[model samples]
Target: MQIVGQTTQLEAWVASRTRKFHINEILIIEDRDHRHPKAEVIETRTFNRYIPLASEQSNLVDTSVLEGLRSVGFDIEDEEIHLGKLRLIEELPTPIRVGAPARVPSFAEVEDLLIKRKPHEGLTLGVIQGSREIAKDMPESLQNVALLFDKENGVGEQGGVPFVFDYRSMDQYPHIGIFGGSGSGKSFGLRVLLEELMLKQVPAVVFDPHFELTFDQEFPNLPEDFRHSFKKRFVTLDAGEDIGIEFSELIADDIVSLLRASSGSITDAMETAIKALHKKSDSFLTYSTRMANLAEALDNEKEIREQSRDEYLNPNDRERVKLLNDLLVKYKDKVGGFSGTLRSVLRRLTRLEMEGVFTSAGTKKVEEAFAKRQLVVIRGSMYFLNVFAFYVVRKLYRKRRDYRDSIQKGRPVEEKFPPFVIITDEAHNFAPKGDVPAPAKGVLKEIAQEGRKYGVFLVFATQRPALLDDTITAQLSTKLVFRTVRSVDIAVIKEETDITAEEAARLPYLSSGTAFLSSAITGRTTAVRIRVSKTTSPHFKNPFEELEEGFAEQDEKVWEAVLPSLPIDASNLNAYLTEIGRKVGRLLSFDELEKTLEDFVDQGRLLKVSTPFGARYNKA
Candidate 1:
């Protein structure tokens, strides 16, 4: 027989049953009378301390028992109750100031008797009928009770063990959210989750600003053919990678906005540029060759080969031109309808999705697998100025939506995208407030509102719940609240959560990694400690240090050489001419200017800060 620890049992029971089950106190009463130490005094509370008495317990003070007194109503004084080891306890007589000596008892007397006899030991058992209440013998370590949706063996009536949901269940809703603070192991957790998604045959598009989750080095030892094929799918966008652009597929608006440019105009420019670049690259074969050549050139020369050895010069435009020239050479054959090509490419790139595909080789013996299984690790360490995490989340949302729209409809319910779960690490950013056009906000809200029907679930992780939107904040069915130091966030969580007032005050003092999981899925809330992830072997970390230590020197060198040549004088006519010339050059597509200005106005920037007053020049 397995002798389970009382604390572990208690925790499991409470967490399994109630969304608010938590341990208040556990006193070990060295029950040396028995060979082992026994838990004598255990104090526990439900999510909402509204404890209901059992029918057996309530019968002790039933109306019939109270009205059967011999004497009429008499005001009673201090009273006591005595109980024998065998029979139940009876109430002691209460002395009256006057006549009858209170021969008969009132309801109060009977109630007091019942309270005293209410089994402090054997007879006192807290039976959890369903997943709501805790049995008296229930131990004290359970946490995170939830109404799980099983996709495999199916859900049972009650108290039965849960079965694992099949992988196809995740495709129903591919969006996921995860939140955590500094050193919270959020990245490690995400990596593991991604691995699970991939193994299940789900395709993924990841934006890794930190670069911790990208590259062959991060995910080692897989099938070389499969790994290489997957690698080709990655389209990195940063200053580092050769073919990589700085634009984001998730929030095209956000990325362009960061450039302090107009979203509409920038998006148009991006679309145009991508198509033009692709078309300008010769043929399919030539395009592939040139792309390879550009990648090689960037990797080999490290810097655009210097045009002059004697004269000091900046190499910015030289590198850009070289890269453009290389791209042209590659896509030279497919250059005609470049704009259309670009639009299609952009659309294809943003179709981030997780789906099950048939993997067994032969046509007859085909097996199912998940699509969108690639692991994306953006170079996040680039700069906090670039919201890489936000960028990735937005992209992920778009992918999920696209996948939902695709597929042959009216098929068997199970055959379609099965239920998928999304877990975001920095949940606060995904669900923020106050009139910001953040892509994550809309996607999170959409999932929160409609995900359940689609089997798309979300897990939000955040150190500060207060920063989250109230609607999204209020809808959390399950919550894992860790140790918090702020009063406001704690109070907000308490007010927002279903836990009792007593539990709120205790939230801020929990030990590190110890948290309370509360939700309607569980009958009560429970407090528990989570095991931390291992970080000794190959680990993922934001590449901030590398850029600072390794890349910064190189970036600075490149910047220095380039700064001297461009027009910089604020008052110089040439500066004005250059600025106007650049603006006019943009007239190659005048629509870009109008659209950008409009977008700026919509975002409150154009209005808040008037356009710089300058002498206007009209091009002849």
Candidate 2:
């Protein structure tokens, strides 16, 4: 250790004999009072005094004088100095006077600072970036306590340190935000995190619009020992397969929001009609049946009231009259004019019903997953995702909140509804900052504000941070920011995170799989390379590769299915297509079959000719 330069409480400049000091390297400065203040090297520079001196004093200094100085052991040309600029990790208890001795910390001291948390204190996310000495000294307990990812320590020739995080701290901090541009490893990092959660048996619901989170697929290239049994813990609720929510569970507001998302805005009359209908009926089927019956009753009553002459009433006629009168009175109080508004509301509801969203059967209750600690993946379109996410999030969040409240009050709580985390990949769609609120925005906002107290957390991942709701963004306790090219997004990240100007500048240039993690749990902003995922999405394949392998097989099947249907003689295109449709058990439109024939003609597989009966096609 040597005192070479100036020192202060927060920063210092140190001169060293060797240029081995690395960026992000930690150093200890000992004051005269023996108080050791830790500092991290932020910048490094090499100094050569001879170059400046030779440039400025060329006329004053002669070559003979330089040679004489060199002979007398005053050779400035042979001298090189290493200078490091360091930022203090914490304020010194006592201000260090100038010229304090700065020295590299021993492995044990660095280990204590980087690892060795109290038992059950925190989960290891990964080792500190760029520090190999600290990486090798990480405690063995950290390996099993946290999900570990291998990262290159800038100092070493081999082996990586494990980066760690205290997942339990999320209970206090609440939510996490993952922001990155396309191909920035945002999705990949999310998979890694989810896998960790799975290993820990934390229940999660993932809203996957892209249908990518099929955890059944084994992690490619992973050792058997490292692979996880996701099939037992993962459940996929596929929208295309008609998995949906129970219509009886949806209120009028949910219907209105679903309508607005699927179609457009709803008028006041439409809203009133929906609410009235919902009030009258117990379920979707009941609502539809009652509305149809009410419309018929009103029509019959109007016809009878407008009759030119009164007819003698029989017993059946009297009962019919009484029923019509009763129906009119019941609906008139609920729906003022049930003609136009009811028709419009029913039409929209019927359309939603036909879309297979409001179903009694095949409803996947999210509470089931919470009870079992399984990862429930709801895969669907944006519209379905919006509506379903709203319902599930609202229901689960309230249940968890109520359960916690019940426990606090010494009341009976449901054991099935436990603490859970909700994850959304395209989170901006759910909690946007725009004027048109997403269907899930309100519930998501509520959870973001108060979910922490109830053991509910949100992991919102999006490419655009600026578009996310400010309340949700502000509530996020941890942010894993990947490479973002948009200046607006970068500005938002810089404002929200504790990253230095240097780190902010590096955001655009950060390599894929690398991110800047800022969290209250870590108490500092760190740049980390997210680990490789053991499990991958089912659709993780190159389109070109898939097409290359599939095209020939598909072409052969199409030819085999079509050739037998073709006539030996010239036949009209429609006739040939009809025959092929019968053989295939599905009919192709005239335009579709015509296009296929035209392609075959171009490929010399068919011959087309103009005849009196219009175009005629034959096998070539």
Candidate 3:
């Protein structure tokens, strides 16, 4: 390869006759005075001299007309030359020498430039693009550190250096955002990231609104020795079952937030009713009771007044009337409103209760997971998680922040809470861009801005970057952008990250499992193919594929029960069906057994014979 064109300090063009230049491949330009400045190929092109650049011209001919030249031993591909445009990684004060030699650098020459840490020291994400050539020369520890996945093939051999991320650097540059469209490997990349975090034993809480974050199952197609089981390293918690909010800990704003998230929006009168009736020590039962009572009081005010005055009323009825009168007199000025407003607030509180948002006392299970340094996967619907996350994130963040603050000021600490990370999918729903009122958005925004100081960070992945909150998006110092076809999302990524125009233009065409990692930790953008995950979600199989596999499993079960009794006479098939039915957990009819035997015969597993008395069955 040679630098054939005029060269500048920042940009140059390299031409090769035999070798194809790859984008993002580092090249050392030969110049003794410049000390071989390193440049990365940003663009590449290949073309033949025989064909016109514009194939739509009137002089154009079909490719079949060119086939005769190949028979004469003239190949058009041999006339093709590869060209690459290079950008210096670090710009120099002066231009480079013209017509200088350019060559690939050895692993040692660019070790410091390419990787910041070894495989064991950082999160091994995947193989870096353009590193396949130099990976062979790398040390054994770095050589086969990761396995890549392909659709046509199973797991491909490790062909490049692993992209080990320095997660410790996240303290300096806090939150990580993953953006991509559907089928862009957005969720696949997230699973890989969480697996790495579990491998590192980073305490985390993953809000799984999709119910697809379980990691107990091992991944298929992995090498025997490389397989890992995270059965003990992670725990899955169902909302309202394993974890929930302690209603007593909530303030008026907490109640308002949860109510707003549950009902989409609350009226001003409903807000006033909540603030007036809810006390600092109120639980869900107490607060909801007060609202219901106020609405009931408004409905039966004249009856209650007359009942309290009537001497014929029983003592219990008189007591209930007296309390109702007192409540009406007490909140007459503060909660003076229609009964519908009070009923509206009561309905929202009841809805949250039915969904088990306040069924449990607290999130002690999540805290216990954190204390053990375990990854706690919290599963719930989008609405449930949104309502619960506001309470959970605020409580845990306050715990960590308070502990860290106490140590910094030399105050006595009452409790011990570890700093942890918060990860979630469908983050745009929680922290949406516009005025969409979601309860979780406020605390998530708080953690995005100030959580790093207390050793708390966020990993938010979403398909819609344009819909994610601007404040949170701006705080995301590291972003993994996968294939996105939407122009609006692409524009947001271009403005948010340091991706060059060339890379931005190629976003719609990137394959699955590939992403452009723009990180402040690396101080540059890297094209990366994500590594295979150690575990997959339980629902990873396509529903249609599951149907076929389910039938096969059922067939195997039935065949196993009948295999030992093979070669029996078809005359005794009824007796055999009764026994086979007991083993397969279902009753079988005579016609069903006859049809099954014929299927086995057609499949070459068995043979049917014509006997003098009747037909007979035998193994094939």
Candidate 4:
């Protein structure tokens, strides 16, 4: 190949004898002085002199005309010339030489530009596109690294340079954002990322709203050596079952936030009532009792005012009246309007209590997994996770930040907590845009902005970038963008990352298991096909496939029991029924047995033989 167009400092065109060129392939521009600048092929074109742009009398050339041209040795295939438009990865002082020879470079030539860490040192996500030429010279560790997957063809053998991400760079760059639309590889790529974190034993907390992050089952078709068991390295916790809020640990603001999450909104009056009624170390019962008493006092205002003069009041009722009087006198100025405002708070509190958000054991299991440097997967519904994530993330982040802050200021170390990464899918629901308030948005936004100082990071994956909070989206330095078709999301991605217009145009057409890793850590945008994971989600089977398999299994059990006594007619139905029922473990009646036998015959699993007495059933 040779440079054939006007060469500029930023771009040059190279012509190849071959008919096609791979976009994003690296080529070295070898000049007389051997400056050896590298450039990436961003676009390609191929044409032939034998075939004109269009036939004279038609919009396109007919096949018969092509056959005639091939008969004379003027075939279009022979004259095809492939051209690649290459953009320099690093700019030069002057334009590249007009006739510089362009060839593929060795791994050593592009290793620094392409990779920041080794497989074990970083996250080996997948193979970079168009790196096969350098694969031969790659070290053993980088060769045949990841098994790429295609939805239509299944798995393909590993080749090309593996894209190992420098996750440690999060200390400087901070958070990661994963963007894509539905049916994109957004969730699949996330699963691979979490697997790498477990492989490295990095402490992480994952909020699984879909409950598909369980890693106990090994992925089918993975090679034996590549197989990994994550049962011990990761723990899945159900919100309000395995982990929840310790109600006594919550303050006034915590209560307000939980109520907002549970009911979607909290009025100013309700907030004021919560602050006045909820005391320190107040459990769910304590808080709920205060709310109930205030509402009762509002309902019986005349009775409360006249309780001191009542004649037939019992001692129990008299003492309760005094306590209500004391509460009303204490918070008369801090809050107002008891029944409507306090009753709203009571309803929210009661809903959360019934959901077990305040009753179940708190985040002890999550913290224990973090201390052991294991991945903790928190599973719950969208609303449940929203309610729990705020408390969990805020509490954990404080521990890590306080530890780091104490070390920085030379203060006495109180309690030790390790730094960890937080990951969540469908992240837009947790941190949405506009004026709406989400439960986890506050702490998540804080972590996104300043968590790097404390070694706390975030990995938020969502199908809609447009709906995510702007502040959090801006803080994500690394973006793994999968197939996104929505124009609104595409516009946001273009403005947020270093992706170009060409790449943005291709977003709607990208297939599953493919993504663009546009990262500040790499300082570039890379087209990547994700690798096959070592573990699969427990619910990987399609619902339709499961339905078919269930029927087939039931039919097999029935066939096994019927095979031994297949030649049964109406006369022997009673005699054969008992034996067949014993084998099948269910009582079979004459009509039920005969109908099933005829259905099997209709399905071609059995045949009916004509006899002197009647038709007899037999295996096909």
Candidate 5:
């Protein structure tokens, strides 16, 4: 150990020796008084004393003269110097005088200074950045906590160290933010974190719009011991597959939000109609029936007003009169008059019904997933995702909050809904910072502010954190930032985290699967290479590759089945498609068959000619 420069309680300049010091490397400083203080190297620089002071002052260094001096017996090489600037992490008991000795800490000293973990304190994430040597000597207690990739030493190497995060820290700071641009391993890191959560048996709901959270598939090269039986723990609510939610469960506000009602009159009118119709019948079909009845009543009222001066009434006048009277009496308060607003609201509601968003049977309840500790992945289009996510998040968060509130008030908790973590990849869409509100935003913001007490947490991942709600962003206690190129986003991250200018400069160039983790849990910023995912997304396959390897085998079978039915002479494309559909015993769309015909022409298997009547195709 050697010290060759000025020192202070907060900072020190240490002379570089044979052992090179790296940025973020921790070092211990000890003076003659025997007081040891810890500091982290933040900057490094090198200088040469061989350059004459007069030459530097004149800004005219003679390179030939310096080279001659160096060629001779001058000690120019010995004058070469390196220095490191270290910021204090731990203060000494007493103020250190100048010329304190600084040295690289031993494994035990490093463990005591930074790597030690309390009992059940934190989950191992990965090794600290720039601590490869010390990482090899991590304590045994943290070895099996979490398996992570070490960027410096590759996967599962000795340089790997336990990066632990205290779970208790979440009580005070609950939410987590994952920010990364495309190909930055944002989703991969999310999957790794999810795997850890699964091992802990924490019930979580993942809003997977792209249907990527199928954890059943085993990881490419993962060991048998690390593999999880995900099918038993995963509950997939796949849209247009097995997923269903009761339409009756949706409230008036939910319907209004779904339609994106902008006008106040339109929203009020829609809400009134929804509440009346929703109360009349719980089934979507029945609700439609009631709406049809209301429209019929409006038509009847118009008819009566126009024909009141008629000398004779219609044969079914009494039935019509009674029906209209009953409808008016029932909906007098709900629908004051059948205006265009009412019609628009009815049209939207009918469209929603046609979209088949709800069902009486096979409705997958959110409570079931929570009760069973299942990782529920709701997969669908953005519209369906937003709707389901809004309902599920709101219902679950409210239940947890109410349960906790009841317990606090000395009242018996009615529902025993377990706490859960809500995760969404496209979180900006769910809780956007724009003026137009998302239905999920209100409840998500509420959870962000108060979810910790209720044991609810949010793990929101987005490529564009700048577009995320400011309130939600502020509430995120931990932010894992992957490679981001946007200046605005980097600025936002800088404002939120304690990353230095040097670290911030590296944000755009960080490798895929590596991230800078800033969290209140660790009480510092760390660079971590995210671990590999045990299961990959089904849609992760390259479509172009699939095509190149021949994705037309199924189409060839259809062509073979239909070719025999085509006449030997030239045939109209539409007629050929119709005959093919009949022969195959399955109705094929004109557009689909037309594309197939075009492909056949491109392949020289069919010839198309513009005849006097129209275009015709024939086997080549």
Candidate 6:
């Protein structure tokens, strides 16, 4: 079936490569030479499918050619799949003299030729079952289609041949972590990958800190239906709201871990205390035992308020005291002696009513708010802190465990606990590797170790990887590395992620928005040019640009907006010196300290007017 007048390069290559056995095609990497244009042609014949030697269990027989596949290696008893070559056909016109032609020969159409090649019951030559047609009902607004690749599609070329690490390959390992500097386009890249999975109906949860990812409006210009579908699947958590769960559902270990308490009898007491804290049937004594640790904090507010009342008796202080009194009265019974020393302390501390740390009304409102929303946003609130992150994570874990237990017990669990994604920004603040407060460390460790299976995924973003928990960092199978100037952080990332030294060195120089994307999902070690997100507004702006613009403005814009935010009363000379010392403690070098002080002076916040003994100080 060789064509009559075609060049024999493809045929010759096939003959040379498949000399010993039947091969689909010989794939050659096309050259980019332009001087001799024809030299750029690299013709390779490809097979849709090839029968390689296989064992009882179907695994591909290893060969020199297959070794090029990175990460995944070949096994015996397997089938070999190859890419097919694309042909450029030149359709010839009717050659005969029209009026006097011996016969009007009907030239075969490409589609008909393909159909004719399907020889009954025998090996059919290269033939397609059907052509892919654009769906007539598809809306014009939808601009992109999901890319599908199967055995027949062949290898796609994206400058070079495109490769995919099949889902099957990543089955053995599944944890993932992403890291990048501010405004590095990590969010955009993550969205693309997530969308791909959603289309496949692979259940996934993502914790988004900035609230940029959860809102439908966040991804504008998308087809309405597509947006709706994505939104329906997401569950958001807000820190402002009180997320509720049955205390009894949580295991003692989980409760202890959530609070970052040390494992021992203390944890047991904490767990017991948490379970008894808000139970309807529990006695005041039981309540006290559960919340005893913070009991003293209850009086802290009343004491402060009473002092304020005696000193200033302002209307605000009066109202605060009234609120505190209401809270104390409501929970006074629960403030009695508890089991564990810490539990008892917490119980007493939490006894303050409206006049206490959390007013009764405030607690109720917070709880009610969290219970209603599927997707919650916890940022942009003054109350949201490192402690808050721990609380939310712990709550979610407890709820998940309770749901599982209910299912096991054949109890009616109406609301399905949807998978959640936890995106922690400035993760070091909550999951610091070294001596951080106990609660943050405990729950974060639990999430890292066990959350993946329970439908919890963590997106930990940090500039300082060296300061992050080693255990949590190690569990991430996917890594997105952006520019990191610190050698320590770069080294930590490289060592943790198994990135080569050459690649590690390049991290410090990565251009803004450029990152090294490594995932088990895409095994090939290749650099990807991230697609710019057209849907979402560019909320993540350059901080330096914002700062420069803010400071450069006149007419009190800078004074009103920036001046009040500074810790020092630049007008007060004594306060300026103390602030400088405090700020300088964080600097890596004395030169930076000096430069910062000079900048402050130049800004007129620190006046450089006079000196004692000719030693000048930056006077506010």
Which pairs, if any, clash in model 3? none
lDDT of 2 by residue, 104-127 (tens): 676567655555344245433444
| Candidate 4 per-residue lDDT over residues 1-620, each given as its tens digit | 77764667887777766636787888898975537888888777765765566223233543443443344344355566566878888778888886677899999999998889999899989988888877779888786668877657676787789999999888888889988888787888999999999999999999999889999888777777778899999998999889989899888988888888788788898899899888899888887898888788777777787995677889998888887777677765577856878888888788888888985477789889988989999999999999999999998998898899899999999778898999989999989998787878989999998999999999999999999999999999999999999999999999999887878988999888789999989988999889998888877888899999997786677788998776677567889888888888888888888888888989998898988998888789
lDDT of 6 at 340: 41
The C-alpha stretches of model 2 lying farther than 4 A from their native spots are 1-9, 13-17, 32-34, 43-84, 93-107, 111-113, 116-127, 139-158, 223-225, 240-242, 293-301, 307-338, 361-365, 547-620
Tell me the alpha-carbon RMSD of every candidate: 24.6, 9.0, 5.0, 4.6, 8.9, 18.7
Clashes of 4: 0
Model 6 C-alpha lDDT per residue in residues 264-323, reported as the tens digit of each score: 224444445454345554433444443442344354645844554475577886665665
> Residue-wise lDDT of candidate 3 within 124-183, one digit each (tens)?
999889888877699888876789988789887889878999999999999999999999
Cα lDDT tens digits for candidate 1, 82-126: 100000011113211111110112223222211222221111111
Error of 1 at 593 (Å): 64
- Winner by lDDT between candidate 5 and candidate 3: 3
lDDT for each of the candidates? 0.37, 0.72, 0.85, 0.84, 0.70, 0.43
RMSD of 5: 8.9
Error of 5 at 18 (Å): 1.7
Which lDDT value does model 6 have at 28?
23
The worst-scoring run of ten residues by lDDT in candidate 3 lies at 54-63
lDDT, candidate 5, residue 241?
Answer: 51
Candidate 5 lowest-lDDT run of ten: 54-63
Deviation (Å) of 263 in candidate 6: 21
Q: Estimate the TM-score of every prediction.
A: 0.37, 0.76, 0.89, 0.91, 0.75, 0.44
* C-alpha RMSD of candidate 4: 4.6
What is the alpha-carbon lDDT of model 4 when measured against the actual structure? 0.84
